[model samples]
Target: MALTSIIAIYALFWVMSAFVLLPFGIKTHDEAGLPKVPGQADSAPANFRPGRVLIRATIIAVVLTTLWVLNYTYGWIGVDAINIFEKPEHLKR
Candidate 1:
């Protein structure tokens, strides 16, 4: 794949990874035994850590993208492997 395509795929994976990692390692004020400020939502996180989130997202994205690249290189999984709608020759008769 082209460099631009790889970068784009990496960015997509990064964003997805961030969302997947968002709910992990989070603590609500109630969970942390901290008093919530007035108007604070009960489910709001006690703290936001962009740096940690970014680091985790980057790690996940790197692993995912590396696997993707390896699959592309080795053809480990192909379209035929996942074809659900295609009828077998024996069944089609």
Candidate 2:
């Protein structure tokens, strides 16, 4: 029981870190009204790429969570908790 609780806690942390920690590492350009640099044309829109960062971070988080779930559940694919749903047989009932 303790092991299952620990696994749940760890998985929670992993998902939360993916959504929080990873995005925070990315630098978003919020500099509106700032002066344009030399060689920078005023007509050109700022090349802020928050979408790319968000997509990449989401991908990474999904991959990490998938691995964690697979490892914990011994090959289970898309579910969250491991011990509660250990075997395919358990789900049949």
Mark the 10 consecutive residues where model 1 has the least summed lDDT: 81-90
Q: Write one digit per residue (lDDT tens) for candidate 1, span 1-93.
A: 888988999999999999999999899999899999999899999977989999999999999999998899899999998888998778998
Model 1, stretches more than 4 Å misplaced? 88-93
lDDT of each: 0.93, 0.57
lDDT value for model 1:
0.93
lDDT of 2 by residue, 23-81 (tens): 34432233455566677655544554566655665666667656766666775544544
- Model 2's alpha-carbon lDDT is 0.57
Candidate 2 residue runs with Cα over 4 Å from true position? 1-46, 75-93
Clashing pairs in 2: none
